[model samples]
Target: MRQMRMSHDEPLLAIDGLKTHFFTREGTVRAVDGVSLTVPRGKTVCVVGESGCGKSVTARSVLGLVDEPGRIIDGRIAWQPGAGEPVDLTTLDPKGERMRRIRGGEISMVFQEPMASLSPMYTIGDQLIETIRLHLPLGKEEARDRAVEQLRRVGIPRPEERLDAYSFQLSGGMCQRVMIAIALAADPALLIADEPTTALDVTTQARIIDLLRDLQAETGMSVLFITHDLGVVAEIADEVVVMYLGTVVERGGVDEIFHDPKHPYTNALLGSIPRMGAGAGRRLATIRGNVPHPSDRPAGCPFHPRCDAAIGGVCDVSDPPHIVFGEARSVRCVLHDDGAAVGGDFRVDGERA
Candidate 1:
């Protein structure tokens, strides 16, 4: 994590062995399984994985957004919450008044699709004001003022006038910015953004990232940004968590995970990233197999079949112990076995039977 540039203070929020599962007709599907992570004050952690990797489920669980069939059957989400002990958010029911208060008041989330997250019937200004008033005991006029200020802070041009416009009236990028403003309206301690830039163009995405970074620095808010883009993870994440089939296979600072990736899954994900300019003309690398569906997860290590360096019998029969490379790095893979081409802490092979 040295390259990721962290301050090393205690985290504002910490997730410990969290699991989110859904009860379907067949069986329970584990979406987030025994995952642990921490977001320090003013630091960002990017949870990167392809679709259906449980990244969204993990984020939703934090905000109590999982509903109906999905449930937080295991683990704890502890938040610093100003000056309190790490409060376990999983114990709070979403509909309960206290949990409701905590959702938008202490913690906020912006969905991947701004259009879907925003009410089509409400004007942008009305929605922003509603969010502010929902958490704060401010009067209508004060809340409206805060809304306009937040809109302006997010770089929404002529925010006062545009506040009256509906969702359809604004472009995708503008709508995304409005979502950002809505999240900021409450001055929350943590922000969970799930693929927030999916609707915007590349340049607009960069601008949004810049705006978010600036706002986080100014407010000292911890952000859990959920995205599949390694490039985005590289640029914005102070720490990284890589997931596969509802499990965290690797966790470290952005530099350690990306530059010195130890897990085969992490290596495969990094290999798939396209290199341009100096690496031009080189064909893009690809990971052949698709992510396993929750209903039919492979036995043993979920990633063994796809891992090129897997030790035949070991990965086929058992899950590897999580190996710690340093204070800032850890990986879950049998490749950590001693004398491996890429080494960490692998056991010596016993003599042949």
Candidate 2:
């Protein structure tokens, strides 16, 4: 195992060759296969891919929530708690004392389904206060005050009254805000937001995204945001990780990934995003094939069949290396062989490959 080197300016978290697999009756599902990424301090890294692309599993794995049939078979999740040394999270027992302290205290997560994540049986205030109390040494009244303060910070109207409300009583957007409050209660160093605005209305979604950005700026916390929408990625991401079936095919700064994507999958995803003022009566572009099933993943490059520039015999038989470029950009594709583009293509409105 390669231990992560610790430094004051190092990333808040570093994941290297991390593999989380699911052992089921059908077969083993390589949910997170050989994935590697870093979450720099006080920056937002967005993981973009379609549903079942291992984005959620990767986030859950970091929180040590991969349960039952699933396991972290290999790799390391090195996290820095406070200004302390880095510790490999993969080595920590999932339900042990150390992991427990890290989960809601050092690293908090706002799950996708707020209604499901928030306990319906408990009052919203009870849940938030419990989290605040667990991580912070405070009296009952103090913890309740902290919870109420967080509620207000997240833009909840009449936060004091809403604190006593149940998850089912509040609207979806309100529940989402409550979830954010619970996650922010401890003021964690890293916040893993897994599709935080999935089912929210357009207005609510914008508010939620803006709230996250503002909170990050205020708290100086790093965020690992997982979403499939490129628009959302463009809005909040400083760095972007593009995942295919279970692997990251590309990673770069937000501008590089959007403006000069090297991988075919990244290009296709950008092309699929609806653009404004492109004239009327034109059909929206779509990635033709669905993400392949984990159990039945194809050989060589996972996206070979769907790639527009896939070279037969080469792309289908040999897996591409993670070719690194200047400015920390990288792409896993045969088309960009020998640090050059074998096939130059352009699809996005103002971009060229």
Candidate 3:
């Protein structure tokens, strides 16, 4: 991330009361139910959750990609432009051409599945040039040159040759690199990378993460990374948001979140990560039970059904409220409600004090 003028003014991107839902035969699935977060300029915020917990949907809604039967029903996503003025992204007309500029130019994103996201019909060079041209006012030659630079910047070996290759012609990791290159060419102030390394091998995953960290460090662009992997969150995120079902269960700085996880869901997630040298012989700790189906979600705390501490009481009768812990930590769990059971200092996984 390049050096930017940091001010005490405001965040690069701020989301408030974000609610995206889908009307399906099952019911109204709340993919992202009232999520609110901020990414300070040049920092990284990660949204970690189980599958279907609305991580991707939240990012998608930010980019206005929610399809039919599904839409961003509420909330505001505002960007702090050059000055201190707040630009409302939600109310802007999609076809105004401004949204297009912002998609790749101001706030870019790299989707999870490159195979599905990238077009096989178009060569990598063609796609990159097209995307660059969309965001920049440069001529074809300039845009192509910038695209090639972006490809090289993203660590694609032999960019000139890779540009001529089709999506299927490259490996999964290469496709993702191309995706990152396209996103980089936009010069976005904020980048939303949705599970950007899920499709790669372990070594490739580490490389991609390192590349992202390096790029973000060089550009100072804020990033919103979505993933279900707590390990990835621990490795890259400066801050963390733990989501269960469609709601944010806990949030805090990386140190506090990893060392003092409070929500049951958050603790369960941490417990499930395989420690080094544990070897494949040992059974990896699992979260037990899949995420509830959207239509058949548990009533009260959506995670109550999976929470071992819950002895079938009000956890099944009422939803827990989000409470502030300290300056930067907060949790949404009945165990921390009022001055209840174990006090707010109690551990969720018996690991934190």
Q: lDDT of all predictions, in order shown?
A: 0.83, 0.89, 0.84
Q: Which candidate would rank higher by TM-score, 1 or 2? A: 2
lDDT of 3 by residue, 40-69 (tens): 778899999988888888888888888879
Clashes of 1: 2
Residues 208-239 of candidate 2: C-alpha lDDT, one tens digit per residue: 99999999999999999999888999989999
- lDDT: the better of candidates 1 and 2: 2
Per-candidate count of clashing residue pairs (backbone under 3 Å): 2, 0, 8
lDDT of 1 by residue, 264-289 (tens): 77888887887767365777887778
Q: Order candidates by TM-score, high to low.
A: 2, 3, 1
Q: Is candidate 1 or candidate 3 better by lDDT?
A: 3
Which has the higher TM-score value, candidate number 1 or candidate number 3?
3
Instruction: Kindly report which residue stretches of model 1 are placed more than 4 angstroms away from their true locations once superposed.
Output: 1-9, 278-282, 338-353
